[model samples]
Target: RAASYEEQGVDEIVILDVSATLEGRRTQAETVRAVRARLSIPLTVGGGVREPDDAARLLDAGADKVAINTAAVDDPTRLDRLAERFGRQCVVVAIDAARRLDGEGWEVVTHAGKNRTGRDAILWARQAVERGAGEVLLTSFDQDGTREGYDLALLRAAASAVAVPVIASGGAATVAHLHEALGAGADAVLAASIFHDGDMTVGTVKRALARLGARVRA
Candidate 1:
C-alpha cells in the first residue's frame, strides 16, 4: 500500500499505529522498516512514542519523522526532549482535536481521540511549535471518517496560531475538499477513506488540485 501511494505521486506517507497507545505498546519498528524499504519518499511514523529512545528506534528503522500525540499531550516537555535529541525538523506533533459540545472551539484529544485534555487546540498548536515541533498534524476528530469535509474553522485557527506547517487531516471526500483545506491555510492535506476505499488516487487528486490552480507535484 505504501509503495502504491508512492507510485501514485504522493509527496509523503504517514503510517500511524492507531492501536499502539490504547494497547500500551510501542510502534512496531519492523513494520516501519519493512515499509521504509519499499518507498523512496519521506515517511512519518507515530504511536506509543513516549521517549527519545522510542523516536530513535523509528528513525533508525527509516522514518524521516516521528509523530507524537498522547505522550506530548501528557507532557509537553516531551516535545522539547524529542526535538532536542533529534532536531526539530524530525518531530511532528500529531494533534487530534474534537469540537466542544458548546460549539465554541476545539479541544485536544489524546489516545486516538478517546481522551479529552480540555486544552484549546489552537493554543496547543502554538505551544507545540514553540516547544520545537517542526510540523503540526491536525486531525479533526468530529470530521475523521465522516468524509463530509475538513473542519476548515479548526484548520484556520490552528494554522493561524502556528508558524510551522500544518497538515489538515480527516473528513476528506472530494478534490474540492482538499482544495478548500489548502485555502483554509493548511500547508498539506491528509485523507484515508477516499484513498483506501479506491475512490481516488494521489495522481488523480493532484490533477484536480492542479486544475483548481493549487500547485501540485507531478
Candidate 2:
C-alpha cells in the first residue's frame, strides 16, 4: 500500500503502531530499516515512543520523523530534547482528541485512543508546538471510523492555537470531507478506515479537493 500510494503521488507516508502504547510495543526499528532501504520518499513512524532514545532509534533506522503522543503529553520536554538532538523537523506530535458531551471541550486521549486525559486539546496543541514539534497530527475520536466527516471544530481550534502544520485525522467519509478539512485550516487530511476499507481512494480525494479549489499534492 505504501508503494501504491507513493506511485500515486502521495506527498508523505506515516506508519503507526496503534497498539504500541498499551502493550509495551517498541518502535519496529528492523521493519522500518527494511522499508527505508527500499523506499525513497520521506517516512514517519509513531507509537510506543516514550523517550528521546526511542525517537533516536527510529531516526537511526531511517525514519525521517518520529511522532510522539502518549508520552509527550506526560512530558512535553521530550519533544524539545528530541528536537535538540535531531532537529525540529524530525519531531512530529500526534494528538488524539476525543469529544466529551459533558461540554468539557475536546480532551486528549492516549493509549491507542483508550485513555482520555482531562487536558484540553487546544492547550496541549499549543504547548506541543512550543516544545519544538514541527507538525501536529490531530485525530478526532468522535469521527474515527464513522466517516461522517472530520471534527472541523477541533481542527480549526487546534490550527488556530499552533503555528506548525496540522494534519486532520479521522471522520473522512467522503471526498468533500477532505475539502472541508482543508478549508477549516488543516494543512493535510488523513483518512484511514475509508481508504483501508476501499470506501474511497487517496487519488479520488485529492482530485475532489482540487476541484473545490484547494491546493493538494499533485
Candidate 3:
C-alpha cells in the first residue's frame, strides 16, 4: 500500500499505529522498516513514541520524521527533548482535536480521541511549536470518518496560531475538500477513506487541484 501510494504520486506518507498508545505498545519498528524498504518518498511514523529512544528507533528504521501525541501532551517537555535530540525538522506534533460541546472552540484529545484534555487546540498548537515541534498534524475528531469535510474553522485557527506548517487531516472525501483545506490555511491535507476505498487517487486529486488553480506536483 505504501509503495502504491508512492507510485500514485503522494508527496509523503504517514504511518500511524493509532492503537499503539491506547493499547500500551510501541509502534512496530519492523513494520516501518519493511515499508521503508519499499519506497523512496518521505515517511512519518507515529504512536507510542514516549521518548527520544522511541523516535530514534523509528528514524533508524527509515522514518524521515516521528510524530508524537499522547506523550507530548503528557509532558510538553518531551517535545523539547525530541527536538533537542533529533532536530526540530524531524519532530511533528500530532494533535487530535474535538469541538467542545458548547461549540465555543476545540479541545485537544489524546489516547485516540478517547480522552479530552480541555486544552484549547489553538493554544496548544502554539505551545507545541514554541516547544520545538517542527510541524503540526491537526486531526478533527468530530469530523474524522464522517466524510463530511474538514473542520475549516479548526484548521484556520491552528494554522494562524502557529508559524510552523500545519497539516490538516480527517473528514476529507473529495478534491474540493482538499482545496478548501489549503485555502483554510493548511500547508497540506491528509485523507484516508477516499484513497483507501478507491474513490480517489493522489494523481487524480492533484490533477483536479491543478485545474482549480492550486499548485500541485506533477
Relative to the true structure, how large is the alpha-carbon lDDT of every model?
A: 0.94, 0.87, 0.95
- For candidate 3, lDDT tens digit of each residue in 25-113? 99999999999999999999999999999999999999999999999998999999999999999999999999998999999998777
- Model 2 scores a TM of 0.95
* Candidate 3 regions with alpha-carbon error over 4 angstroms: none
Error of 2 at 76 (Å): 1.7
- If scored against the real structure, what TM-score would every candidate get? 0.98, 0.95, 0.99
| Per-residue accuracy of model 2 over 53-124 as CA lDDT, tens digit each | 998889899999999998898888898898898888999999999887596679998876668788899999
Between 2 and 3, whose lDDT is larger?
A: 3
**Ranked candidates (TM-score, high to low):** 3, 1, 2
Check candidate 1 and list the clashing pairs: none
| CA deviation > 4 Å runs, candidate 2 | none
lDDT score of residue 205 within candidate 3: 96
* Poorest 10 consecutive residues by lDDT, candidate 2: 1-10
